[model samples]
Target: MMKFKVLFLLTIIGLVTCSVNAQRGVRIGYIDTEYILQNVPEYKEASSQLDKKVQQWKTEIETKLNAIEQKKKELDNESVLLTKELYDERYEDITFEEAEVLDYQQKRFGPEGDLMIQKRQLIEPIQDQIFAAVQEIAETKSYDFVFDKSADVVMLYSAERYDMSEQVLRTITRTSKRSQAKSKKERQELEDEEVVPVVSADKDERQQALEDRKASREEQLAAKREEREKAAEERKQAQQDLRDAKKKEAEERRQKVIDERNARSGSTSNEAKTVESDSTAKAKSIVKADSVKVQGTVKKDSVNSKMPKTAAEIAAEERAQKLKDREARQKELEARKQKIIDQRKKAREERERQVKKNDSIAKAKKNEDNN
Candidate 1:
């Protein structure tokens, strides 16, 4: 009884395992981070402001670099005329000035460059807060996995249905607002850190205009070169392809002519055979007719010799016999001519049919060969 109970327990466990396996399945979702970042007003405002700030910093760095380069050029130009002592003194001065410039630049825009880094740092936490909310949503909704929709890896997806970015953005915006409202000191610190000495507004504008002009000229030159190269390559390829196509067409035409000549030759040979047979038949008939005439002439001569009669009677008999011989020869010639004409006609018709059949066969073979 104990063994039977154990076996029943094992069976119950197996059934339960199968039921659990059937019920278990994963739910997955996707989110478009870029869409969320762009559509959310707070994120849009922050991103635009950050871009402007970064551009300003980049322009300032460019101006500084240009100034340094110009100064170096000036030093090089002066070095040729100066005495060693004077040159050394001037070089020391320039070196000191460069060191000062570098120190100031590093202090202002080093690892702790401007308030932008701080702003990004602050904003990153807010993004993390949104990520946390997304995680919570996934867990609560029984989702096993969630993927970022803006990523390159997610090439195709259900557009509207897969996007949870809007909800995530809203959560982030609310969190950021509440966090800012709670921390006045941090906001003031951010504000204070944003103040930095920058180039004069007019000079900055003039420099930017110069840079834009230079960039535009470079772009135009590069584009013209690219266009010229592309046009040349296309022309070369087109000429090559034209040559290849012409060669192929010429080959096909030559093959077709060869096939047509073969068909004509075969038809001509068949017609020649028919004509030869008809000629032989007509020649045999002529020989048979000539033999019969010879026999009749011999028989007539013998009869004339055996039976002597009046001259008028003999003349009338000869005339009648000559007329009969003439009629017989004419009938034999007519029958031979008719037979030759009929044979010629049948040969012509057969040749025509054979030519047509050969042409059709040749065409089919040509098509098969081409394929």
Candidate 2:
């Protein structure tokens, strides 16, 4: 997550860097590599040679493979007529030929193969020459950076003023002329030959190449757009799923709370039934114990028939004991219920906080991607 934030910050910083480069009057120029390659005589010849060689190798490989297939077919067809020894020998011969053909293909076209070697050998030098020219021009002009407009860089807008393609082409022309000339007369002739008009074939090819590049860039942009739209749709779907899951969880939690409350109520009711039965038995025991007290009261009453002791005093004491016991039991039940409620409230609050945190993170990530 922190890495994503850093990447977002870096992207913003890159935009600012470009703006700062402009404000500071940094000398950044660009060139068309395609144009340069198109004009370079050596590169054109090397590319043509490479294409010819590749075609030749491809035809040779195909021919050998076809020969192997034909031989194997003949061996299979003649298998029933030939003796076991003869058939085995013919099979081995076909197998060897097939192996040889495959080996040849791999030598020419496999990983770390001759085709790749030939490509690097032919192309790398031309690329190095171009790079040297570009670097020399950059150093002499004190340019901050030289961008290749022909490559796969993406740009929404650009100005023509920063294009140094013509400048680079002129340098290449002069350099080529210098390398080809020996005397002053030839040098002068080449110098005078610099501004010849373009042939129609070359002009048409150049136009076609530029068009192809434009078409390719458009395809790439379209692909990128499709990918972005797909990603956004996926994110939206994911968020919706998360919301649904969260809602279902909340519902389950609510149902659980209700079930727990119902269970507690049922348990309390059962407890109250047991307590009532116990209280009735205790009341009968008290009645039985009161007979002795009444007998003693009768003896005392013989002396004084109208007793000063009142029934209200005994009633008040029994009422006071019952109230204290009832309050204690009520406090215990209330404490148990409150504890459950408090625990549930804490759990719910924590879950909500976590959901909010995750949502905030997702929003931040989405915002970053959009930017």
Candidate 3:
């Protein structure tokens, strides 16, 4: 039968080729029926259901066969004690069971059996779909002849350009999609939906929509990253400004203390000079007044005049106290600045750590969603 088909195909090809020069050339195409069947969802589902039925039938047959075998074994074991008539009855029953099992197997698996009938029924609709698609394509594309590559007719060489399997599959898919609708209105809606291009496998609307969604998500992620970077930069700038402000305040305080120290030093120098001038004038007075009584009076007056030296000492003590106070204030200011810096540093680190945690969480969620 296969050789006959091949010979017929060759004859047709030769005739078509001979007529091409005298008439319009035949536009020939081929499709793989097997490929079409594999791609059809309804067909695959029906095939699965049919396979399950076949398995169940096989199991039933096996169970009956096992029962028959067990009965035979029992009959053999008990034959020595049984009477001839009883033994004959038992053997006859066993034979009947075996015959019944054979009939069941024939009924289930024979060429004209239920399995074949149901399988044919299941495939008839799919075959109709393929035929309808092929007819439509032939009419639309003005094909003179269309062949099934998966059929018994063997072709040693067929060009890929002449393969219409994908187009047929697409057409069948559209038909199945329409038929699946519960109502005429829904069917119409499905029919009105955009048809995928036959030549372009990547032109599926759902896949395109998925790619669009992916692109949108990536853009959103990029925007979020930009926002994070901007916020981090702003935070860093704020920290720097805070540090500058603290430094300026501390510098101002230090300069003020230095000015106060210089003022005190100048005043102390003036007081010392005044004390020295008074002592010199008093010495001159002591030399001028030479009597014992006058000399004693001068000594007492000079002692009274020496009070400025004590005042200068007091001024020196006050300057020392002020210097100590200034040093304490400076130390306190430095500590406060350092504390603020530390606090800000910790805050920035905490924020960055939290951002990282959030990023990790978001990434995990995204991965989960993808899975």
Candidate 4:
């Protein structure tokens, strides 16, 4: 209830704010920050670099922890035979290493840590540029108010046309392209005079080696990421194909079973139809014979002597006809009910077969996996 109340108040406040903005003739627009970030190459590169570093750091941490665990196990196993002095030294060494690992983990992953600082440094410039680009777009478009749809602003509805992210991205992209072109032109002018590439000739060999190692590390990280993604995609496609094959096989088996059942029932239906036809023909023959016998027993002026049918007699014939119609309808209903029942039975059987097939497939897969 408290949450609901808070939400209600917030909604009311938002409505009032929008209403005030509208009364002041303000135009509103929104931008998706996440979308803009996705479009920014520098942001992606930074993120990938961060991810690589994080992975490396995590691996280092795990390796250190595992080493400590192994040493502890060995010390425990040999403790009974070892002298107290030696045992204490080994245990002290393990504790020191464990402390070092914990310190390193905290340095990499704790709040206000090296990784956090590096990440902030990496993204701060990009974020500033994005904000500047957004500002420029807002100014040129004469937008009175712009909101970030990606932010924690509550949005019950948003229209696509009001989005200004594309505008911001376009502005940023143009600036980057111009910067690149200017740099390239400068490099070309230098190259036209046959100037050699700058190789930091004054730098120490150690510094140069460090820079070289950093470049190689980045390249390896990029290559590994690409390979991993490619392998993952291939695995996904293979799994999809396997699933499709299984589904196709299941469907074909079910269809074949239904077809065979229908064929068998078709013969029975044909025989029933033949028997009904014979019964109908026999019934018609008997009626004809009775009519002839009645005609032979009647006088020649029987029609003339007979009175016309009264309303009650006509109504009686109509009632008889209605009863016969109702009986025919009941028979049709029964037939339809029987068909539905048969269909349900067939469906249940098919489901059971499918379940059995799935169980067999699962069992086979488990066996394969175990092997």
Instruction: Give the top-scoring candidate (lDDT).
Output: 3
Model 3: residues with Cα > 4 Å off, grouped in runs:
1-24, 181-371
Least accurate 10 contiguous residues by lDDT in model 2:
195-204
Question: TM per model?
Answer: 0.39, 0.42, 0.45, 0.43
Model 1: per-residue Cα lDDT at residue 82: 83
Model 1, TM vs. native: 0.39
Q: How far in Å is the alpha carbon of 245 misplaced in model 3? A: 80
Measured by TM-score, the strongest candidate is 3
Cα lDDT tens digits for candidate 1, 1-371: 99999999999999998886456545556777767666667667776887787678667766776777787788789888888998888778778777777776775578776664756764676567668868866755555678876677645537464466766775566555556754787666554543333333356447879999999999999999999999999999998797678657866876786688668767865776686677657766765776676566657767776776767556766765775686677667767866776786687678667867876786677567545
Model 4 over residues 135-186: C-alpha lDDT tens digits?
7766665567888887899989997867878877876766666567657776
Q: Write the per-residue lDDT of candidate 3 for residues 121-150, one digit (tens) a residue.
A: 998988998999999888776677999999
Q: Model 4 segments beyond 4 Å from truth?
A: 1-24, 183-371
Q: Whose TM-score is higher: candidate 1's or candidate 3's?
A: 3
How badly does each model clash, as a count of residue pairs? 0, 0, 0, 0
Counting only residues 3 or more apart in sequence or on different chains, how many pairs clash (N, Cα, C under 3 Å) in candidate 3? 0
lDDT of 2 by residue, 223-281 (tens): 99999999999999998898777667756775676577567656765765576567657
Candidate 2's clash total is 0
